[model samples]
Target chain A: MLAFVITTVLCFITYLLLTTGSGTLGLWSLEEILVGAILSLIVGSLARTIFVKDNFRMLNPVRWIIFIAYVIGPFFVAMAKANVDVAYRVITGKINPGIVKISPDLKTDFGITMLANSITLTPGTLSVDVDEDKNDLYVHWINVKKKALEKKPVNYRYVCGKFPNWIRRIAE
Target chain B: MIFNLIIYILLAIGVFFNLLAGVGLLRFPDVYTRLHAGTKCTTFGSIFICGSVILIGLRMWYTGSTDGSVLAIHTIFALVAILLTNPTGAHAIARAAHRSGVAPVRAVVDDLQNNTLKKEEEK
Candidate 1:
């Protein structure tokens, strides 16, 4: 119920911002504010009921701050590194191309999403698919690790590296 | 001047994110990952771009331009369309990739494939 109220308030505030403080029928009016509040309350309740599950637990605010920090920090750095690697591959055509699987230990959907998105942002690798039940991802590598590919039970430790760990920080 | 600054800032942010999506397409490791990055980032970036356009249109409307309102509203509709379709398309691509047996590197067990194969044999 409290979540509904907060959501409604936020929606109302956004409505005001988007409308640029303007009221319908030419002038700002108290009636408009009241109508906006009521409308937003209904919309917020609908949104809460539809998108948010009942069992969802709210995280500590500090955790969110940490998550954003990781997104800006390590994630960006990884993206930059991938950029260089991909650019080199594009120029030199040094790709040992093939499909490979990497099993990440991350459990949650959001964590997996973050990992997948981070991987996709990097060059020379494409996330082909995810086996949700097994928590595995199939990636098409522009440059495969020769040693890992040669070995049965490929050492994906090298392929996936610190990605899933970093993703855990941001999303899980 | 402040309005112009805000519009320009939104435009720059939108363009930057769009470039990130493009780079993501070139760099990511697999088809599914590429779709994830390409779809979500582009959608986000497009929101900002369309937002800026809306702002500019509103500003023009305020300054007595006749076409501003129509332009602003249309851009918003387009933004909504992109938001609605992009994720659904990405989900389809991911499912197709999985069905095609492009497994993740180092994955231990594939439950989806097992289930699908089971269903196939039942038929």
Candidate 2:
């Protein structure tokens, strides 16, 4: 029930965003809103179970704010730094490419997914696989540092630089 | 004039990174490294390009154009879609490559395979 409502709201918001200024009203016409509502309701009923299983905690506004802050803040900085690093490597042909395993130990599926996505999104590292039992991520790192491969307790700073912590805050 | 200049600069930077991504794709050694170049660089470049468009829309809105807000908002939706989808697609490609037996260049360990074996033994 809650999932249905959440999905409906989300879908409607997406519909509204996509259909911005298509109507006689300020943003949407009454007829368009009706059509959007019907469409969103159909979508919500269909995908509610898949989207929000039992994790209503993730629907919290605070987590969303934190996620927004993360994107605009540390993640942005990390991406810029990664772009510079990748650009240098591309220009100079200096790269030590290898795959290594890092154990993030995030329990929730959403947390693990977010971390994996973050790792893959940031340059120089691509998440190649995951150990489902132990929650370890095998990442293909473009410049494999000796410190990263020493199998030390996986430092979030070294592997993904603050991504795990931020993901924990948002999803876990 | 200043806004156009900034937008042009952003567009140039976006194009530059995209060009570097193409260069890296050709020059990099293997599948994994090539994926890095192909995915992240384009994503970053697209971000800047979309951002410049959003700026243009905002400037138009400030000049009393009603269509500007709609343009800006829709561009944001596109940006969000790109940001969300690109990395996941890259991850899928990387995982598929690894599963299909594409090893990294000069890799020292295969912990993923080791862990899978360990799990199988435990079962």
Candidate 3:
């Protein structure tokens, strides 16, 4: 609870700083800041309690820094590459047009969300759905792989794109 | 001068990503893939665009323009609304597509269909 309060305070302070400069808050702005702060505290506490009910392992600063770096680095890199590939395909009309399944060996829901977000952010791929039981992602790829690819209309891969590994580093 | 430069850069980044999103939507195959390109890219691109507007608002506020301040603040709220709603809407569309049986082009194993089957069997 103490940590939650600290986080809430920090979040409110950051919000204030980003939204309005320091030490010059007018009465109206002060009221806004106070309201925002109260809301932040309530939301922060609720979010912490609900999301971190069982484990608060993700709150570590080191893990967060590493995660941010991973997301901004390799994940962005993959997105860039995909963007180029997509552009080329669009210009040349070389897209294979297929859907493939990717089972990125992820344990947590956060990991899955990261992977899905990464894929969705990329230019040519769409994360269709997830199999909640086995935790597999149904992805629709612009260009399905040749060898591993079958025409069965339902393919899943353990390692299809560079997305899974990058997301693994970032979120898992 | 420096502030204007930052705003221009932000606008450029935002416009580039927005164009990418549009291009992806046009070029990508299938409904789901097009939706992916159309939604996420625009969301990211719009962030930078709205961010530039926010900076412009701050600059105007400093220069004592009430209209500029209002414009900037309203734009920020609009951006927030977009950010909150876009992805959730996209997810809903994708799920609808899957339920409607829009299978991946060359998919080998469909865990979603299998899951449905399993649920039916359990029932």
Interface RMSDs of all predictions? Answer: 7.5, 1.4, 4.3
Local accuracy of candidate 3 as per-residue lDDT tens digits, B4-121:
8999999998898789878877876667657756776787778789999988887887797665656676787787678556755676688788777776544434446665567678
Please write out the lDDT profile of model 3 over residues A75-164, one tens digit for every residue: 657556665665566566565555455667787888787667666666566677777776777665666556765434343332335556
In candidate 3, residue A53 scores what lDDT? 48
TM-score of 1: 0.58
Higher-DockQ candidate among 2 and 3? 2
Off by over 4 Å in 1: A2-17, A20-36, A54-58, A150-157, B1-91, B94-123
TM-score of each: 0.58, 0.93, 0.70
Model 3 alpha-carbon miss at residue A82, Å: 2.9
Report the CAPRI category for model 2: medium
Complex DockQ per candidate: 0.15, 0.68, 0.31
Q: Candidate 2: where are CA atoms >4 Å away?
A: A152-156, B113-123
Clashes of 1: 24
Task: For residues B6-29, write the lDDT of model 1, one tens digit per residue.
Answer: 999999978876787687678656
Docking level of model 3:
acceptable
| lDDT score, candidate 2 | 0.84
